[model samples]
Target: MGQKINPLGFRLGTTQSHHSFWFAKPKDFPAELQEDERIRDSIKNYVQKNLMKVSSDFEGIIRIEIHKYKELNTTQVKIDFGRQNLLTREEEEEKDDKEEKKKLELLKTKAKIIIQLIPEPYEEPHILAEYIALQLKNRIPLGKAMQKVIELMEETDIKGIRIQIAGCIGGKERAHVQWIREGRLPLQTIRAKIKYCSYKVQTPHGVLGIKIWMFVDFVDEEFVDFVDEEFVDEEFVDEE
Candidate 1:
C-alpha cells in the first residue's frame, strides 16, 4: 500500500520568508560592511525590488496552495521499485511450473488392471478361493492364480471351464479386493457384472478407470493358502 500525502506543503511557516532567498553578491564587499545592519538592509531592499519587477512583468502568475508532502529519497524508492519488478516476474513463472508438475504427477499414479477366472461346478468354494489367490498374484509377483486354477481343474476332472474375470478400478493405494459367492439374484449378477466390466473409480483427489479380462485353469488350495499366509502379510506390513 502506498501512503497518500499532500504535495508542495510548507513546514514551520518558512514559505515567503527571507531565509528562502538566494542571491549572488560581490565577494569584494568591505569586511566591516558584512556585519553592518545598514549594509544588510540595503542588500535586502535591492533583491526585493528586482524580484517585484520580475513578478509584475509576467503576463499571468498562478498561486498554488502548499501542503506537507512526504519525500522519498532516491535510494529508498529505487530499492522498492526493484523489488516490485522482480516479484512480478517470479510470481508468473512459479504459477506456471506448479501447474505443470501437478499434471505430470497425476499421470504417473493412475490405476489400471485386468483379471479372468473360470469357475467349476460342484467346486464353488475351491473356485472362489482360487480366484482370490489369482487376484493376490496379480497384485503381487511370482505367483500364478491361473496356474492354481488349472491345477484344480486337472485334479477334479472338470472340462470346458470358463470363469468371467472382472476389472477393478480404484486408487492403487486404496483399492480393496472383495469376493462374493451368493446373494439375491439381481444383486449377485450386478456384482459379477461390475467385477467383470470396466469400472471408473473415484477418490477424493481424482478419478481413474480400468479395463480387465483374464483366463485361468483351476484353483490351488495350497497356493491360495500361501498367498493368504505370506503375500498378504508382506503387503500389509510393507504398507504400514
Candidate 2:
C-alpha cells in the first residue's frame, strides 16, 4: 500500500517540490483549495482551446505553481503556460473578438490573474499526456492511441516512459485500467529524475484519466526546468 503512493509525493522532500505555494488559516483553507482547482481548470481549458493555433512552436504546460497572498487577497498562477513571449498570443489576437474573449477568459470573478510566462524546454510528460487526451477526445481506440504515443516517444532520447489510462476506455459499459511502457524506468531510484503528469479527457462515453511518467536524465544537469523566474507576463483581467 505504501508503494502505491504517488511518485511525486513519495520523493517530495528529495527530488520534487510543491507546485502550489500558499498558506491559509484553518477556517479559510477549504475555499482557497477550491479556488486552486478552479484556476487549474481554467488554465487547462485555455491550453486546449489554443493548442492547435500554436502547436507548431507552443508546448504543453509542464506544471502550474500557485502563490496566494493573504495581505493582497490575490493569487498568482505561474505555469510554463509555454509563452515563448506572452502568456497567450491567441488571447491578444482575440481582443477585437469579444465573444471568444468572453468564452476563453478565466472563470474567476474576483481574483486578478497575473500570468508569469517563462520558456520551459522540458516537454516530456505533459506533451504526451495532452497527445493521449486529444486522441481520446477524437474517438481514437485506446490501443491505437497508446501505440502512436510510443512511436512518438521513440524519436526522443529519453531514458524511459510509462503511460497509464483508466475509466471507461473504448466506450465500454465497464471501467478498467490499461498501461504501456517502454525502455528503462528506474522508478525506485531516489536520484532518478522523472517528469510526471496526470490528465483528464472528456468524451462521449465518459471521462478518462491518463498518467504519464517520463524519465529525464539524472540530476547532474542541475534540474533543467523553469530555470529563469525573472520573466513575467502580468495580465490584469477585468472582473466579470
Candidate 3:
C-alpha cells in the first residue's frame, strides 16, 4: 500500500538545505487541534517522508515578485541646459556703455590759444616753427609756465609787457594752444592781433621757438590746459 500524505500545510528541509516542501491538509484533518505544535510536527514529518507531493508553482511566483521590487527602486530624474549663456551676454553690454560716457565729458571742458608765426629776417621759416612745437610738447601745462613768468615780470616791474621773438620766421605754420579760462569775451566775434616774441633753439632734427606772451589774466592759463587735454586728437599729435 502507498504511504498516506499529510494534508495539513507544512515546511520541510534543514535551514541550510536547498530543497524544501510545502503541503496542504486533507479535509478530514482535526479542526480543534489544527494549530497544535504536535499536529504541525506530525505534518512536517510526513511531508518529508512523501516529498514528491510539494508544488513547483509556489517557488516560481516568489522569484518573479523579488525581481519586480528591485526594478521599482532603481530609476533616475531629468534637467534643462541653456540658462547660463543668456546671463553672460547681459553683463558685457553694460560695461561698454559706461566707458563711452566718460570720454564725452572730458572733451567739453577746455579753451584754444592761437599762436601765429610771423616771419622775420635771417631765420628759416620751418626752423622756427619746429623749434616752438618741440618746446611745448612735453612742457608742464601753461599754468605753471605762467606762474614762473609772472614772478619774473614782477621783479622787473615790466608793465605793458611785450615778448619779442628774435627769429619768428614761418611762412604759413600756425600753432594754437587752447585751454579753459575763467572770463568770457565781451563779444564772441572779437579778433585782435596780439604781438608776442620768442627765442629759437636749434635741435638735431630742426629749430625750435619758444614764444612768450603777457597774460592780462591768470585764468587764461587754466583754460588752455583743459582744451588741449580734451579736443586734441592723434592727428594733432602727429602734426608735431
Candidate 4:
C-alpha cells in the first residue's frame, strides 16, 4: 500500500507544483519531453562558460523552467540562481552583476530567446544540493560538506533540514550512503511544506547523488513573499 516516493510528488496538490508549464500534442510529446533536458543543459553550459569568462565562482543554478506558447510562437525560460557571491569588493561585484545583465539583454536580442534570471532564496533544496555538488567536485569530504551547509542553514528559519549523499563517498572504492539532519522533518505531515530536490555530481572517483529535504515553516512565509516582491520592485525603481 506504501512505497518510497518523492515528497514533492507525494504532496503535489498541497505544496508542490511543476516548474514548467506547456502542453504538446501526443505525436510531439516525446520530443517535447526531451526539450526540457536540452534547455537545462544549454543554460548550464552557458552559465559555466560565462563564469569562466568572468573568473567567478559558480553561483549555482537552482532551477530552470520552460513555457511555450504555440499560438504566440513563443518560449519562455526562467532560471533561478543560488545565493553565491563573487570574491571582490562590493562596488566591483555590483558592477559585474550589472554587466552580466547587460550581456543577457544582448543575448536575448541576438538569440531571439526570452530568458529571465531569478535569484533563489537562502537554503532552498536545489540551492543546497548545488552547494554540496560544488564541495564534492572540490574533493571535500562528504561529512564536512554536509556539516558546513547545515551549519549555515541553522542560522535560517527553516523548520527542519535533511541531506543525503550516496556513491563512493570520501573517494572510497565502494559506494555508501551518508546523511545529516537538523531539527524535525515530518514526511507524514503533508502540511509541513517540505521542498525536495535530488542532484547528481560527477567526481573523479565516481558519480555521487545528493538529496535534500527542507521543511520550511509557514509562519515566515509572508515575510518570504514580501522579500521576493521587494527584490523585483527594486529592479524597476532603481533602473535608469
Candidate 5:
C-alpha cells in the first residue's frame, strides 16, 4: 500500500503538481517557451544563480528554456526538474490522483519565492564613492588628487589602497593612465579582506576612471606592530 522512494529520497510515482511548483507562472509568460531550445543556456545560468538553493543540484543540471515571440516581443521561461524516470506515467498513480490533489491544496500556500531586492541598506562603497566624488570636484591635477585621496584614506582603518585614473588629464589631447598606492595591493594579495569601488570623473581634459581599493585588516600585526632589536653592552678598556 506504500509507494517506493528514489535514491535521492523523492517519492516515486508522486505526481509533481503545477500548483506545487517553485516558480510562479506569470500571466504574460508564454507556455511554449518551455520547449524552445535556443535560449536554454541563458535560462539555465539565470535559474542556477537566482533559484535552486542546493549547489549539488547543479551536478544534476536543472534544464531551463526560454522563447521570445514577435507578437509584442514577449518572453516565456520553462523549467524542467530533469528527473527522467519520474517523467513516465504510472497507472497506479492515477488511482491516487484525487488524494494528491487534496494534499496539493494544503501545500500550495507554502510554495513561494521571497526575493530580497535590496539586501544591504548601507554598503561601504556608497560612503567611499561619495568621498571620492566630493574630492574630485576640485579640478586638481592627477598626481595631487591621488596624493590627497591617499592622505584622506590614511585617517580610516583601511590597511592598503590603490587609485588609478585614465584619459586625457589636465586638458591634454593624448590619453594616459596612472595609478598610486600605499602599502600592499589589495587585488594581488591572497587571504586579505578587500573592498573595491570605481567612479568616473568628468573634467575639461576628459573623463577619468577612479578605482579605489581598501584593505580591511586593521589589527594585522605584520603591518602595524613589530618587535624591537636586542641591544647588548660590551666591556671595553684597553683601547681607552
Candidate 6:
C-alpha cells in the first residue's frame, strides 16, 4: 500500500527530491518570446531571479524545458527545481527523522515563494492544482470530485486534461480507480505531447493517488481523417 497521505497543506512532504512544473499555457508574453522554448526559458529565469533576490542563502539549480506538441504551434514549458546544497544524506541521517522532515518542509515552503513569480493566464494551472488539493480534503465521492475538476478545467485554455485517482475510495476495503477527462483524451504517442503531475491527497478513508495529465491539444485533424478513412476501408472489406 502507498504511504499515508501527508498532512493537509503539506505540499512538500513527500520524499521527492525535486519539484517541477510546466506552465499550463503561454499568455501575454512578448511577441519574440512567444515560442514555447523561449517562454520556458524566460519563466525559468524569472523564477530563479526572483527567488535569488528574496533568499540570498538559497543556491540551487533550475532547469527549463520546452516540449513541442504536435506540429509546433502548441508548446509546454517544464521547469525542474534541483535540491543541490539542501543537505547530504549523511547530514540528514544525523538528525532525527521528524526533525529532518520539518527542516525540509520549511525549506520547501521557502522555495515555493517562486510561485508568485508566475504571471496571469500561465498561473491558472497552479491555481487549479491548489484547488484540486483543497477540494479533496473532505470525503467527497470520487466521481463527484473528478466531475468537479472537469467543470473547473472547462473554463480554462487547457485543450485537454485527465485526472486519475486510485485507492480505498468512499471508505471501501477494496481499492478502486476513478478518473475523468475534459477536452481531448491524453493519448500516449510522440505527437500527443502529454505532461503529467502527481500528488497524494490524504482523506478520511485513505491516501488517494492523484495523477494529472495535460495535453497540448487534440490530435491533428489529418490523423482523425486518416483514422476515418481506414475505418471506411475496413468496413468495405468486411462487406465483401
Among the numbered candidates, top TM-score falls to: 4
How close to the true structure is residue 106 of candidate 5, measured as C-alpha lDDT?
33
Per-residue lDDT of 66 in model 2: 71
Q: In lDDT terms, how accurate is model 1?
A: 0.27
Model with the higher lDDT, candidate 2 or 5: 2
Instruction: Please identify model 4 stretches exceeding 4 Å from their true place.
Output: 52-59, 84-121, 218-240
lDDT of 6 by residue, 1-240 (tens): 766442112222221112222233345343324443444444445434554565432323233433322322233233334433333465333322433243234322111111112222221333344446556675455667667777766766677887777888778899999877777843534345444556666777788788776665533432222122221223323332
lDDT of 2: 0.66
lDDT accuracy of residue 4 in candidate 4:
80
Expressed as tens digits, the lDDT of each residue in 28-128 for candidate 3 is 23531332233224323432343213421111100000000111221010011111222234333342233223222322212111111222210221222
- Clashing residue pairs in all predictions, respectively, total 13, 0, 23, 0, 0, 0
How many clashing pairs does model 6 include?
0
Per-candidate local distance difference test: 0.27, 0.66, 0.27, 0.66, 0.42, 0.46
What TM-score would each prediction reach against the true structure?
A: 0.18, 0.67, 0.18, 0.72, 0.38, 0.42
List, residue by residue over 27-79, the lDDT tens digit for candidate 2.
98898788778777766666656654665323466677776555554555566
Please write out the lDDT profile of model 1 over residues 59-164, one tens digit for every residue: 1111111111112100000000101122234543452344234323432321111111222322332323334333543453212444454455456533323333
- Where is model 5 more than 4 Å wrong at Cα? 1-129, 218-240
lDDT of 1 at 88: 35
RMSD of each: 41.8, 6.0, 51.5, 6.3, 27.4, 20.0
Tell me the tens digit of each residue's lDDT in model 4 across 1-240: 777888877776566556666788999888777766766666677666666457444556676655555555445555565644532355345544544454345333211223333344556787678778888888787778889888878878787999998998877889999898999999887766888889888889889899999988543222222122322333323332
Question: Model 3 reaches what TM-score against the true structure?
Answer: 0.18
Q: After superposition, how far is residue 82 of candidate 1 from its true place, in Å?
A: 79
Question: Which stretches of candidate 6 lie above 4 Å from their native place?
Answer: 1-116, 120-129, 218-240
